[model samples]
Target: MKSSYTVENPDYQLSPKTGMTRSHYIELAKYLLEGAFQHIDSFDDILTFPLIDGKTYPQEDSPAWRFRSLEFEALERTFTLAAPLIHNDPETEIKGINLRDYYANLLYKALTPGNPNSLPMPEDLPDSTYQYTCEFGGLFKTLLLMPDTIWSVYTEEQKAAMVKTISAWGHHRTTQNNWRIFNITTLSFLKKQGYEIDDGLLLNHLQWVVSYHSGDGWYLEQTYNYYSISLFIVYTTIWNRGFGDEYYPEISKTIEKSAQKLMESIGNFFGRDGYINMWSRSICYRTWVSGAFPVAFMLENPNLLDGGWARRLCSGSLLQFVTKEEFFVNGIPSLGFYGQKDYMVQSYSCPASPFLMFLPFICLALPEDSPFWTETENDGFWEDLGDASTQTLLPSPGLMLVNHGKTGTSEIIPGKVYYDDPNYSKLTFNTHFPWEDQNPDGGTSMEYAFRSLDPRDLRGDDINFYLTGKTVDNDSELRAKFTHSQNMLFNGQRDGVLYRQAIMRQPPNNGVGYIIDLAEITLPGGVLRVDRTRLAFEYELTLGHFGLPHIDGVEATVEERKLADRTVMIARIPGRSLAFITYHGWDQAEAMTHDGNNAEADSSTVLFARKTAPKVNPKMEILITAMLHKMDDSEWTEEELSPVKDFTIQTFAPSGSPCGVQVNLSSGASHHVDYQNIDGLRTC
Candidate 1:
């Protein structure tokens, strides 16, 4: 049995790595849905959840949520969980109501006129931006993915009402990003049913999404966070499965190729044991990572993945969250990554929102003969990176994926030019160290920052990529120039080193920002960063490492090492370990603590390094820092905690950053970083 399975009675034969076979999935799905299912008393009863008054997220009565209905959110999202379950077990019953029959009847009432809980169609709603437009797409996808349970069983009148409702929602407004895919999926289903749809708009959406394709799959060019997976791939596959052949065969064929390529790259996103390195927003939708697989397998796409590897990953991710005893709250998946993690919930989340985590269950709908079920499970990248680590450079998204073999950690370093919040501008995001709890008193977010001591800066918090240097100058909406990074280059990394550059100023505006270049080398334990500062010398710089979960009644740090110009701090419990090192160009290091500020633990601790430029400042300044994560209790070796073997800076040539610098590690790995040609690079 898989050790990750915290619950008893796990099956190993079908899934040597996860014990999550077709039948196992059926059982797991029932357990998960039971939370919402137990409250059902009749075929037409809407699933209602009690609100915690002012504590309600998205604020129940706020103007932003004027178009949102708690009842509709609770009912529709729960059906997302029930759709696949009923596909495999059509006769499933809950609280004396047939799961399939309840949804079909409830939806019919919701779409028909005069019902108390009837959903307002797109035109009738206050505006086209109604939440119902985003929420109703799943109903159409469910009807298409498994028609017998809802669509086929419906009467002619019931079918017409739902279709008309979907058709209206199809024409509603959409966010420029992934929301457009929802319209495509729901409208494609209507088109497949021989109904009329604006083919121009439909084709337009397909073309628009295809335009995002940045090569090597994932449409990876700058697609942020869960937008790449949950919405884009999920609905695209649903549209492809239901109508791609007859509607747009050429684009469908291209999507198939892209999906296959995406599968290979996404495989690295998960560790050997299957914990997905999650970053960015939508932290509540934990299992959506598994959405990548089943659709490809259902279509029988070849060369997509090793069947054993796919299930192992799907199962691994499921076990990580589902096995936690605290995963549920009040009989449903909590609005947090784990149980009641207030720090993990987004402001936009509603109570029943987490029910959309039904992707992994799609495997249950696959036939028994599929390789996804027959193949023996095996480790994905662990088979290759036994004791080493490597990084994948995705040029379009300007992303680097690091696979840490010894400790089962996945780290992503993305080249971000502009950001609205800290979530987007962090130097890196790691699966092991999830973005820390965003509390005021909590340790700060992981970033390479310039804490503005100058009262001139309008914003108070430490500067991220956008340095608000010489603050208080432009009072026009607290102006800070974008760190435009169109020049995110890969000129280095000939030997495991990553070199890149980004201009930090808004040209044409004549803003005062730097043309900064950054370089990194991924070691087995952590990443070594070489950051150059061209900002004015008065601003003090601070580097914040990933926050470590702190245990109550225990010391925040297990051990710490301090040198004249270097220091290392380590924190760990039984299962997770974290290390932070300030190697060079820093004056002081301190570990800060906060209460109830972590998603995974009760408290969190972070090592923050601070330094100001020397009195005799040069045109360019450099800082080096490293962070490591592990899953074991062993102490770090000297080599693992040692400073860089060598670092060279030219005394002459005397321009901004040295034209080229060589930094080496004890392992004989060397990085030749050159910024001489940065002037010729592209500007964003």
Candidate 2:
């Protein structure tokens, strides 16, 4: 059968399109739900859905059951959206399936005692896994969506069984991160149903969540990433709206302010095309990033996001994912973002995890006459700010973002990456290029080496860093607490330049150390990296230039040329050009290919410049300037193409001490970088 929907303004090249209205989204959700149910003979059969890539994830219980819960979770959002229409209009149906009967039957089968399809109850073990907590959250949410008629259909025993099931979940221990919401939401639902719950237990989770708020409207969930904002917004909004005054009045008050702060910060992550920064985990839940928008609307003072802009961003993000043909298999969303690329999946993510993308459909809960539905769509900040280049420094996250409106390219340089995950550790994240996982050596803007060590020893992998480090003084900043295991001593950023001073410990030789200093600068389409080393004893040092994205069969070419005193290595690809110019400390440049290292399966080519300290002096310093021009070859002359050549760098000290550099761009703008400053440098 033909697809039942299409998206408005679909980017046919990127996503698959079905339809664009609320009805279309509802139909799509229903279609996916039906497709999943078709594979199951009974609810227990949900444990038999095929795992993507035939990968086995470690779990005592079958993982496929999670998909069942996820499917129900997605349906809950659809049902809530359809509740008003189904109740107000008797003739309403989604894809010819009567909404009320369809949902009521499913809910009854899943929750009714002794039903073959009933979900397993929460285990009473003290160390029970968090999955049970998550599953219970979904079940409780689905029941909340039931209309009065559907609610009345449930026998008293069935309702009591659900209450007992949810009550057990509330008492069970859950993960301290986002999973806390599962307990909070479940208890809130039970309380709303007039069931008494442990007020202290509920209050404790709420207090922990509120205390976990780091700053600038972000909550720490394992590490700083997109989940910090997206999931936090959803859960807190539910708490504030459901049990605010009656349960935790203080939490309700704090969440309102935090939610607004988060809403204001979330808009920056989306590009003009509405795709979010692909820098964090759970990428399969693509449009769910728009979940924040719906949460904004649910707030009492919903002024954080304009109605027109909300619709645009929400619609745009939804379309970006839904339009991709590869997003689904047999009408069910696969375990990948656009297709079944398993590199991005975490251990906890199963085939059904992608259904979390349904969070945005919560907007369907709003009335048909709400301004969110009626307002003319606005293009959001990207369009509102015009084509001028703008930069925003998010201190809480230690992220510096530059949006080049004219070029439609945005780049983010994070000051802190606490995770070993490369998607978070990469020096720069670009909206146009989704991060790649297979090629660790490619797409990185910064890399370094140590003396006499094997390549593997010098290799930078899973380096833990964070932007939340406190500034000790004007000249030095403390490294984040998580980086204590590493040799880093002081870290600071000044005028768009990030700097660090550390003692490198050579492993296997306990006492050996090398004094290391590093600095970085990021521009719209370029980055500058510098490294200086002083060995306590005789040792060698090597520093690498940034690597550029390399896609096969798109006309790739590399050229080596001399510009004044520097040797410049330039790589040209479709619609873009990257130039790597080494000013002070490189021996040679080489082109290397990394397979499975990028977002796409195709290999990527990287250019590197290495520097080694002489044994006699054991001292070496290197500076490499990498610039990107976003225009295709046809758009510029040879002179205009080499933007890196026109840029000049002036050192603040002879040995690059204080590790300062001033870059004068061809545009006549100057960026002054002081490595000693703990706070990042201000841009021109």
Give all candidate RMSDs, comma-separated: 4.6, 7.6
Worst 10 residues of 1 by lDDT: 479-488
Lowest-scoring 10 consecutive residues by lDDT in candidate 2?
Answer: 475-484
State, as a TM-score between 0 and 1, how close model 1 is to the true structure.
0.88
Tens digits of per-residue lDDT, candidate 1, 363-463, equal 76667778787887888667878878878876555677888887777777765434424445566777777766443322364665443333334344333
Compared with the true structure, the alpha-carbon lDDT of candidate 1 equals 0.66
Cα lDDT listed for each candidate: 0.66, 0.58
Best by TM-score: 1
Q: Could you tell me the TM-score of candidate 2?
A: 0.80
- The segments of candidate 1 whose C-alpha lies over 4 angstroms from its true place after superposition are 1-8, 52-68, 220-223, 341-344, 437-445, 455-495, 500-516, 552-555, 563-565, 614-619, 652-659, 679-684
The reply for model 2, stretches above 4 Å from the true place, is 1-5, 8-24, 27-48, 54-100, 124-126, 138-153, 384-387, 438-493, 496-522, 530-562, 565-584, 607-617, 629-657, 677-684
TM-score for each model? 0.88, 0.80
Q: Scored by Cα lDDT, where does model 2 land?
A: 0.58
